[model samples]
Target: MLNKKVLSCAFEKTINIEWHKGQFTTNNFLHILIHELGHIFYFYDWETFKINHIFYLKQFLGHKINNLNKFSELDKEKVLKIFANSNYGLSDDDELLAEGFAYWLLTKQSMQTKIWEFWNEYFTSYLPQIRDKERKEV
Candidate 1:
């Protein structure tokens, strides 16, 4: 049984990790947890995050454009390479961020590209500042 209020709160900065015994390996569990945390980070400053990463949003959306013939073959290849690490990221902007976050943390490697640089900075620097500011407000 799930509580509707709690479920609603989940969209409002609440993160609840439901653990199902033997359902996931340790690696999968950590990946999922980090991915969910990425969602919370995005929710913290939705507009700013979206604005700051518009290039990525556009590139991710390019996957769809490729199907419509609006994107060139080179651009499509670039988009494919960018999202090769996580196909799920091709789904949408939010999923792209979350999947990238999980991949970055799990691999413990810097992507060194412009979009990933922003993502890394968001999780490492911006998000902490936001949290600190909120703590002061409370």
Candidate 2:
């Protein structure tokens, strides 16, 4: 059976805005929306993502010093910046990707940082292909 998932957002209530430092601004809403879209994007091609990206990300953050050692200094710095952008992302690889995606789309500083290169690559290369495939199916 195909499973269905729901993503709910209540913009009117203060409770929904609390996690965003208690402000209900358009920027905050955009961040939340983009972050959730990132999750949807991940789930859309989960098998490919799990094999290509998640495995390496898990190893880099996992409990082994040797795994961390395998990454270059630049790569490590980029990963740290991703976590720094949103501490919530530290919970897991999926959050990391979502947070990175939000930061890449919403923050001006993100353009200068290599931290969001993965998102750039995905958007420029994979997104068009995904769109084209959907168009053909329809």
Candidate that would win on TM-score: 2
Which ranges in model 2 have alpha carbons more than 4 Å from their true place? 1-9, 12-27, 47-52, 56-84, 109-111, 122-138
lDDT of candidate model 2 versus the reference: 0.56
Tell me the tens digit of each residue's lDDT in model 2 across 7-99: 233343443555665222233656877888878766765644333345444444443234766778666656554443555666566776777
Per-candidate TM equals 0.43, 0.50
RMSD values, in order shown: 10.7, 9.2
For model 1, residues 29-122, the per-residue Cα lDDT tens digits are 4577788887776666554433334343444445434363475756654664474345456556666677777766766455366655545665
Q: Which candidate number maximizes lDDT? A: 2
Q: Could you tell me the TM-score of candidate 1? A: 0.43
Minimal lDDT window, size 10, model 2: 1-10
